[model samples]
Target: MLCIEVLVEEPSAEAALKSLLPKLLGSRARHKIINFGSKSKLLKVLGQRLAAYAARINKGENLRIIVLVDRDQDDCQDLKNKLEVIAVQAGLTTKSNPDAQGQFMVVNRIVIEELESWFIGDIQALRRSFSSLPSISPTSSPFRNPDNGGSWEALHRFLKKHGIYKSSYPKIEAARKIASQMNINENRSPSFQCFKAGIEALLSQENENLN
Candidate 1:
């Protein structure tokens, strides 16, 4: 059986993935979510965590590790390179640098700007979660590209304009609700699509191993 270990930077992400991963992994694979409380804390401890996973893999564990972080204000390429370097330092192959057979034990994905970009990417999912929200056109200004900066703030403002989360956005609650309605196949966020693609690749590799 294939087991996936997902490392996320915050509770909201954990909440969102909790609702989404079961739908993605199905009965063919099992997954565990590890929330690191904050992005700073996660980065501080990431090296140690990856080292531990490398040790487990050396013991012949059928485990795959996924590290997810928000791009926030960081340069995307630099952030990705940092993650790849960490995995290599831990003696594990990353998706960015696969082995000769094209197999990798780790995948690093960034939520472009922030997790709320995913909510902004899928207007239908947002409407499903918050029924009172007016239909938003994907061609509209900010909604057109959900990967833009200030994603959570943009989402909060949009929701507040609709009288939902009028005071403040509840990160975890909104994440769970919006993610539950998200169509993995239909999200418009490029980052979200990349994330979904990474999971699909992991599953594909697992199937190849089984064969």
Candidate 2:
């Protein structure tokens, strides 16, 4: 079986994935999440982490790494290129630059704006998580493209408007709740879809290896 090691920048992303990965991987794969406390910290030590993983892979361990970080005002392509460079420096093949056989040991995904964008993408999931919240049209402004700027603020405002999270948003709590109810297939966020695609690609590779 393939063991997936997912590295995320913060606790909320870890909380969200805890509920969502099971729905995606099922019995086909084993996975673990490693939270780096903050995006700055994660980026600071990412090279060393990937280098360690590369050493393990060289020792014949069957492992794949997935790095997830929020875009948060950064140039998206530039951030991606930075991650790709780190992986290459660590001697690991990334999804962006696969080997001759089209196999890679790492995938780097950026959550556009923030993780809450995914919650906004699936309005039904948000409603299911917080029943008191009113319905939001998928085509509504700002929310129509959940990947737009100020996504977390947008979500928090809507939640507060409905008397939920009246003070500050408890990110981990909201992520756990909303993500548990999220239908991966129904999410409209392009970045979320990209994340799903990365997982699917890894699973597909595992299946091909078994064959």
Q: Per-residue CA lDDT of candidate 1, range 118-151, in tens?
A: 9999999998998887878898857989998899
lDDT of each candidate versus the true structure: 0.93, 0.94
lDDT of 2 by residue, 1-211 (tens): 7899999999999999999999988897899999999999999999999999999999999899999999999999999999999999999999999999999999999999899999989988988998887768878865789998798898898888889999999999999999999999999999999999999999999889889
Q: What number of backbone clashes does candidate 1 have, counting pairs of residues 3 or more apart or in separate chains?
A: 0
Q: Candidate 1: give the clashing pairs.
A: none
User: For each predicted model, how many residue pairs clash, with residues at least 3 apart or on different chains?
Assistant: 0, 0
Deviation from native of the Cα of residue 48 in model 2, angstroms: 0.8
Residue 119, candidate 1: alpha-carbon lDDT: 90
Off by over 4 Å in 2: none
RMSD to native for every prediction?
0.8, 0.8
Q: Which stretches of candidate 1 lie over 4 Å from their true place?
A: none
